[model samples]
Target: MTVFKVFYQHNKEEVVVREHTQTMYVEAQTEEQVRRYLKDRNYNIEFITKLEGTHLEYEKQSEHFNVEQAE
Candidate 1:
């Protein structure tokens, strides 16, 4: 599985700005898989980016970083 960083807004119809968005990490096979999982929660997905190498390691260091495995 690869790690993805999902930026989203909860229950909002308007475009989610970067500063106003919430983030989460997901381990999924593809971007579509991540979107499908998050759709259940009805989050307004702003972006999905593959995280790896140095960037992925940097994010992992944050106290708030947590990876949710996508089933």
Candidate 2:
């Protein structure tokens, strides 16, 4: 499973807008897979403002988790 957070701007005011949070599990095994998925979905390349890597952790005893940059 791969998760992506796509951010965009909707207006000239420059107010940042979080467009979508997407999670996909694809059989294809490369960056090209995700690229093709985006193209197939007709997601505009211009709308994407920024992308950040997400680090996910899980603990059996805890029900909650957090996302942070992994160094």
Candidate 3:
């Protein structure tokens, strides 16, 4: 299976906070798979900016980011 990098954007809102745009990423086989995975987790699919192959070299070229929790 090929490693597909999925980039998507979404919004978050709470009783005391305003909505804002947030970025997300996932490794999947296809775009549809990524969509399904996110949907299953109740994440809305606002926009998909791009999809590309990770080239299986995650160690050499991958950039990591921290996911923050909403309060």
**Which candidate wins on TM-score?**
1
Model 3 stretches with alpha carbons more than 4 Å out: 1-19, 51-71
Candidate 3 positional error at 47, Å: 1.1
Tens-digit lDDT track for model 3 on 21-63?
Answer: 3445555556676666676453445555333345334422546
Per-model TM-score, in order, reads 0.90, 0.29, 0.44
What's the distance in Å from true for residue 34, model 1?
Answer: 0.3
Candidate 1 local lDDT, 1-71, one digit each (tens): 99999988886677767778999999999999998888779788888999999999999999979999998
Clashes of each: 0, 0, 0
Task: Report the C-alpha lDDT of model 2 over 1-71, residue by residue, as the tens digit.
Answer: 33333322333344344554323322233444445555535343332222224332222123432222211
Per-model root-mean-square deviation over C-alphas: 1.2, 9.4, 7.6
lDDT of each: 0.90, 0.34, 0.44
**Cα deviation in Å at residue 71, candidate 3?**
28
Index of the highest-lDDT prediction: 1
Q: What is the lDDT of residue 54 in candidate 1?
A: 100
| Order of quality (lDDT) | 1, 3, 2
Worst 10 residues of 1 by lDDT: 10-19
